[model samples]
Target: MMRVVPLQSSGVRGHDNANVDFVRESFDSEAFGIEIGRIRAAYATSAAGYRLLFKSVLQRARAEHFQQVLRRTRLENLEEVWALEATGFEMMDVVVTFARSVAPAAALPVWPDLRVEEATDETFEVIAHERAAAFFVGIMEDRPAGYVTCVLHDHTGEGEIELVGTLPEFRGRRVATRIIERALPWFAERCRVVTVRTQATNIAAANLYERVGFTLRCTEATFRANVATALRAQP
Candidate 1:
């Protein structure tokens, strides 16, 4: 089983008040009959702190025969001293925020064969498969078409769009948009803001949010390193 260690503060925040965490953990190494460990820094961790953390992880990896050690960092936070070239890169994710006050009047789409409804336990199970603060499902001719799950933060008056998806056959029909439109009023009543995150590379998803009046807030990057190689080169 893959195991994750709790994030540890690195006490380094770059110019933007960004901080980083040192993450070290193990996974089902023995299941595969090989020890696999991972070490990474998160957020705005300082370069010095990352090196220190990496050295300690390297020592542990050697003694434990760890077959692999993975490290991840944000592109912005990455420093020259880490000395680990990125093998691959994934586009940063973009965060978008919407406000209830500016939300347009709920003009639900009228589909001749499709209808929007609150998700029942059975429908919710088929869609989200987990308990959600609130959920909405779209049904087309008695068949499940799409769904969206929402979680509300009462204190912050923020509502999160945890998941939204549509069956492949229902794509390009605005099934997702309608489901989200239907849920907005519900969210607006109780939450001041609604937020969602999507990969920056997902232009379709970004366009969808823009059509719904969500404003782009920020983006975050992801970086990776092979600690096993770094340690082997150590003299």
Candidate 2:
């Protein structure tokens, strides 16, 4: 069993804060220890997003070999680190979803490189099952040019425009907008608020979201490390 550490709460000004918990566990793999902090948003929304603040402990314990196998174990689920204070808060932002019934007058440029079309049976079915999703394909000059998918969260009424990659030749045209237009109604029918989460560092995506009336909600720093590395450093 791992240990749970409770930290003092600083009571951030915005949104309701919750008690935070830290998870400490030992594994049979090369990694000896795994420590991660888990924070739960205080809102009552059905969709929940968890921020993993730290993941270096497994690396410290030299458990790299076992990390993969241990991830599915029950110990990882029950052992969590939680801190109620803002210091422990890693991310903040409420996803936005809009009604499809209302069309945003934003002009949609014709995708220059590709013709617009519906997704195939396989792709459509897969995207429909996602948490936040939109899926569409682009055809250019009688050929399948590109495809994209957006994610939607039913619990939070939020939508995310993900994997909007286009064929290098098909990028200049508005293939992305065409897909977004087709997906808007689908999201509106089922969700109240639709939002697109993209890397703020990507100017093109950020522009697309703003053009479609998506407002910026918030931002958070992310960290990642291998368990094997952490284990070697541990004394």
Candidate 3:
């Protein structure tokens, strides 16, 4: 197989627990700069040639004092999986992206005391720095129960649900679902297709999206290696 696009997000597995701020500074690294995501090469005529390329890249990353390294491939790419395993990389996580068309919907219900509304300056702090995105919060009795962060790409005609979360105490109450339900109309006004991603291991999250009319789009495997440890492994 041959390599293609090399875009990488800041090493997040797309889980709700991941604290990716989506700020440019968080992704910047001065120590080592190469293609950080989706590294692949042509299939090896012999196993030796392919494995050597991975070795060379990992070694260089380590030499540059990078603490950790990551690569992602589609789950169907067995050759890439095996190559990663052979080169001392361990599968960190698998993530699935889901998409749904945003159509006018009958309003979904929320708890009587729980208010699902767009975040205001006082309720959401991130809005101070990020003006283009939208935040919906589940406020029960004036206390924040959960929130969903969304972004619209006008050029692409798409909206991305960047993060979905509910406080630990608020779990199982459908707070997340209600917040997302509230966010949908906001997206519908700006884009037709909305997408969200969550870890494959998160069954509850996967099911939640489906329940909300999202269909599975794609899944990718992320492999991680400690720079020094990978370099020390033999073969």
Top of the candidates by TM-score: 3
Q: Please give the lDDT score for candidate 3.
A: 0.68
lDDT of each: 0.58, 0.42, 0.68
- After the best TM-score superposition of candidate 3, give how far the Cα of residue 215 lies from its true spot, in angstroms: 1.5
Candidate 2: C-alpha RMSD to true structure equals 12.2
User: How well does candidate 1 match the true structure, expressed as C-alpha RMSD?
Assistant: 7.4
Candidate numbers sorted by lDDT from highest down: 3, 1, 2
lDDT of 2 by residue, 20-48 (tens): 23233221121435343222222211112
lDDT at 69 for candidate 1? 53
Error of 2 at 43 (Å): 11
Candidate 1: stretches off by over 4 Å: 1-45, 50-113, 126-131, 153-157, 224-235
- The local lDDT score (0 to 100) that residue 124 gets in candidate 3 is 64
All candidates' TM-scores?
0.56, 0.51, 0.65
Find the number of clashing residue pairs for candidate 1: 1
